[model samples]
Target: MKNTVLITGSSTGFGAAAANYFAAKGWNVIASMRDTSKDKQLNKQENIFVTHLDVEDTASIDAAITAGLARFGKIDVVINNAGYGLFGIFESFTKEAIQQQFAVNLFGAMDVAKAILPHFRAQQSGVLINVSSGAGVVGFPNASIYNASKFALEGWSEGLRYELAAIGIKVRIVEPGGATQTDFLQRVWGEGKNASIIPDYIPFLQKSEEMYANLGANSDEDAVEKIVAALYAAATADDDQLRYAPTSDIQPLLNVRRSSSEEEFNSFTNGLFLGK
Candidate 1:
C-alpha cells in the first residue's frame, strides 16, 4: 500500500522540497503550512494536499492532523520541519524570543508527536522524522538560542525512538549543516537590545551576518536532497539508525565530539568562540 506523509511548514524550504520529493516518489503528501492560501506552489501539485497548520497553535495542529487523517486515510509519517532560528548573541536574546524558539521548534514537534502517537499505536507502524541541525550536537557563536532548541529536539527524538520501538513507530533525527539558499536565515530574528549591551560580541555578530548574507553556508539543494533520502530510508530501511548527519562537515565534527575528551572539545569550542 502507498503511504501518506504529513509535512509541517511545507510552504517553503526543506519542508516544501521534501513534500515534492515524496509526492514524486508515489506517496500522498499532506503539505502543511500556517496558511494554505499563502502556499501557492504547493497547492498546484496533483499529489499534494495543502492544509493549514500553525505549529505554535495547539488548536491548529490538532485540526490539521484530523483533516490530514480524514483526507488521506492514513498518515504513515510525520515530518516536523516547522521551525525558525533566532540568531543572536547569547546575552542579547530576550525571554520572549527564546520562548518562541522552543515553542515552535521543540514544543511544536512534541505536540505533533503526542497527537499522532495514538494513531500510530493503533496502526502499529509509523515513522517520525525531526529536522534538527548540526547545531543540535555542536554549539556555535551568536546562535545560542537556536542551538538550544535543536538540542532539545535531538534529546526528545532520542528518547521517543526507544519508547516507540516496540510498537514499530520509529523516530529519526536529520542534522543538516548551514544551508543558505532558504528563507530560514531570513526568518531568523535577533534582539538588538540584548546584543547591543554585549559590546565585545558586535564584531563577531557583524562577521556572522556578512557570512549569512553572502551565502557562505552550504547549498540548500544538496541539503534538501539529503533530507529526502534520509526520510525515504527511515520509512523503509531494514536497519535502525538513530541519527542522520546530512552535511559532510558536520559528520566529522560529530564524530570528534562523540569520541573526544571533554577537555579537548571544550578547548576547540573555546578557541572558535574567541576567534569569532
Candidate 2:
C-alpha cells in the first residue's frame, strides 16, 4: 500500500506544492486547509483528498486527522505547514498579536504533533516534518515574533526527535528562505493599533521594506521547488537528519552564522538590515 501523508495549510504556497508533489509520487495525500470550499484544484486529483483543518482549532485538527484515516486507513507522515508571518517593530506588536503569532506558529504545530503522536507510536513508524524558517536559525529585523516562534519550533523539534526515535517515529525541520512566489509577504500581519502612523518608525520600516524587496528580487527562482525537495528528503531520509536548509539564497547567510563569531555575525546582519 502507498504511504499516507497529512499536510496542513494546503490551500497555497509550500503546502499546496507539497500536496501535489507527494500525490504525484503515489502517496495518499490529505491536503488540509482552513476552508475546504476554497479547494478547487487539489480535490480533483485521485490520490489527494482536500479537508478542513484550522491549526488554531483543536476540533478542526482532530476532525481532519479522523477524516484522513477514514479515507487512507493510516497516516504515515504529518507535515505541520500551517502558519503565517508577523512583521513590524517589536514594540509595535500588541499582546494579542504576539499571542496569535505563537498560537499559529508554535502552539499550533505542537498540537498537530501531539495529535498525531499516538497514531505514530501505535504504528511504530511515522514522519513528523515541521516547516520552519531561516529566521529560526538567525534573527531578522521586523520578524521578532516570527523568529521567536520558529526558534521555539526548531528547539522543540530537536528535542522531540530524541524522544520519538525509539518508537521509530522521525521528526525533522525544513527551513526555507523567503519564498517570494507565495502569498507569505502579502499575508504578513503588521503590528497592532496605528503602527503605520508612527513617524519615528517610518524611515526604519521603509529601509526594512527595501531590504526585503531586494532579497525577494535576489531570491532563488526555484525556491518552492527546493523546499518541496527538502520536505521529500525529510520524509524519506533513512538516517537522522534533523534540519534541512533548502534555499540557495540563505545558505550563505547560514554559513556566515556558523562560521563567524557572534559579534561578526551581528555586524554582518546589521549591515544587511541597515543598508550599510
Candidate 3:
C-alpha cells in the first residue's frame, strides 16, 4: 500500500514544494493549509488532497485530521510545517505578538501532534517531522522570539522522540538554514512594544536579512527536495536520526557549534554580527 503523508502549511513555500515532491514520488499527499480555498494548485493534483487545517484552532486541527484520515485511509506521516517568523527586537515585541508566535509555532505544532498521537499509538507506527529552522539549534541576532519558538520545538521533539520510539512513533527535526522566497521574511510581524522606537538591535536584523537574502545560489528546489527526502527517511528508517540539517550552511554551523567551546562559538557568532 502507498503511504499517505499530511503536510501542514502546504499552500506555499517548503510545505508546498515538499507536497509536490512526495506526491510525484507516489505518496498520497495531503496538502493542508488554513484555507484550502486559497490553494488552487494543490487542488489540481490527482494524488494530492488540499484540505483546510488551521493549527491554531483545535477544532480545525481535529477536523482536518478527520478529513485527511477519511480521504487517505491512513496517515503514516505528518510534516508540522505550519509556522511563521516574528522578527524585530525582542524588547519591542508585545505580549500579543509573543503569544501569537508561540500559538502558531510551538503550541500549534504540539496540538497537531496530540491530535494525531491517538491514531499513531493505535497503529503503533507513525512519524512526526517538524519543520524547525537552523535557529532551532542556535540563536542569531534580532530573532530571539522566532528562535525561542524553534528552540521550544527542538526541546519537544527531543523528549518526544525517546518517549515514542518504543511505541513505533518516530520524530525528527529539520533545520534548514535559509530560503529567501518563503513568505517567512516578507510576512514578518514586529512586536509593537518597541518596534516603532527602533532598538539598537535593528541593525543586526537588517544585516541578517541582507545576508540571508543572498543565499540559495541555485534553485531552492534542491534544498526542498532534500528536506522532503529527509522527512521520508525519518518516517521510514528503523533507526532514524533525531535531527536532519537540510541546508549547506546549517550542517556546517551545527557541526561547529557542537564541537566548539562556548567561548569559541560566541566569538564566531559575534564576528557574524560584526560582519567579519
Candidate 4:
C-alpha cells in the first residue's frame, strides 16, 4: 500500500515542487491550490490529483480533503503550505489586509489541520507539515504583519505537536530562510507600494527598501528541489524532531538562534536587519 499526501498551494513554489516530488517517489499526491487553472503540469501525473483549495475558506479545505480521501482512499500526510507575504509599514496596511494575512497564513493552516485530524485519528498514523519561514523566529524590517502571522504559526504548531503525537500523528515545521520566490515579495509590494504615501514615514520606508534590496534574497531552480526534499523528509520521518531546514543555507542561522540567549539573539539579529 502506498502512502498519500495532500499539499496546499500547489500552483507553484514549494507546494508545487513537493507535489511532483512525492508523485515521483510513488506516493499519491493531491496537489491543491486556490486556482486550479494555474496548475500547468501536475495534472499529467497519474498519481497526482489537482484540486482547488482556497485556504481562507474552510469549506474549500474540507472539500479538498474529502475529495482527496475519496480519490486516494486515504491520506497519510497533510502539507499546509498556502501563504503569501504581506510586507509594508504596518500602519499603511488596513485592518482588512492584516486579517486576510492571518486568515491565510495562520488560520488557514489551523483549519486544514483541524479538518484532517479525524482521518489521522481514525488511522492512528499521519504527519502534518506546516511550511513556515525564518521570519517565524527572526524579524525583518517592514514585515511586522507577515512576521506576526508566522510567529503565531510557529507557536501554534509547537503546542499542537504534544496533542497530536499521543494520537500517533507527527507534526513538523519546515523553515526556509529569507530566500524565496521573487514573485512572493513582488506580490506584497505591488499592493502596498502606492499605499506608502504617508510623507512622515518616507525615510524609514526608503531604508527598508534599500535593506530588502541589499539582502539579495531570491529562489532558484535548485531551491525548489531542496525544499521538496525537506518536505519529503518531514512527511516520512518517524523521529520526534519538529523542525527542518531545506538546506544548510539556513542551518547556521538556526543554530545561532537555538543557542543564543535573548540579548545575544537580539544583538545578532539587529546587526543583520539594521546593517549595524
Candidate with maximal lDDT: 2
Candidate 3 lDDT score at position 93? 66
Instruction: Tell me the tens digit of each residue's lDDT in model 2 across 125-189.
Output: 99999999999998987788889999999999999899999889999999999825334233333
- Model 4 lDDT, residue 144, Cα: 87
State the lDDT of candidate 1 residue by residue for 106-210, as single tens digits: 999998888889999999988998989888998866678989999999999998888899888889888877635234223333433333356675566566655
* Candidate 2 or 1, higher lDDT: 2
Residue pairs with backbone atoms closer than 3 Å in model 4 (clashes)? none
Q: How many clashing residue pairs are found in candidate 2?
A: 0
| Residue range 1-276, candidate 3, lDDT tens digits | 789999999998888988888888899998889977778787898889888899999998899889888988999999999998777667766788888989999999999999999999998999999999988888866578989999999999999989898898989888887746344233333433334444465556557766556544432447777777777676667776888886675776688789999999888877765577
Output the worst ten-in-a-row residue range by lDDT, candidate 2.
185-194
Pitting candidate 1 against candidate 4, the one with the higher lDDT is 4
- What is the TM-score of each predicted model, taking all chains together? 0.88, 0.94, 0.89, 0.92
The CA lDDT at 250 in model 4 is 58
Give the TM-score comparing model 4 with the true structure, all chains together: 0.92
Please report the TM-score between candidate 1 and the true structure: 0.88
lDDT of 2 at 149: 96
lDDT of each: 0.79, 0.87, 0.81, 0.84
Model 3 lDDT, residue 87, Cα: 71
lDDT of 4 by residue, 59-138 (tens): 99899999998999999999999998887777777788889889999999999999999999999999999999878877
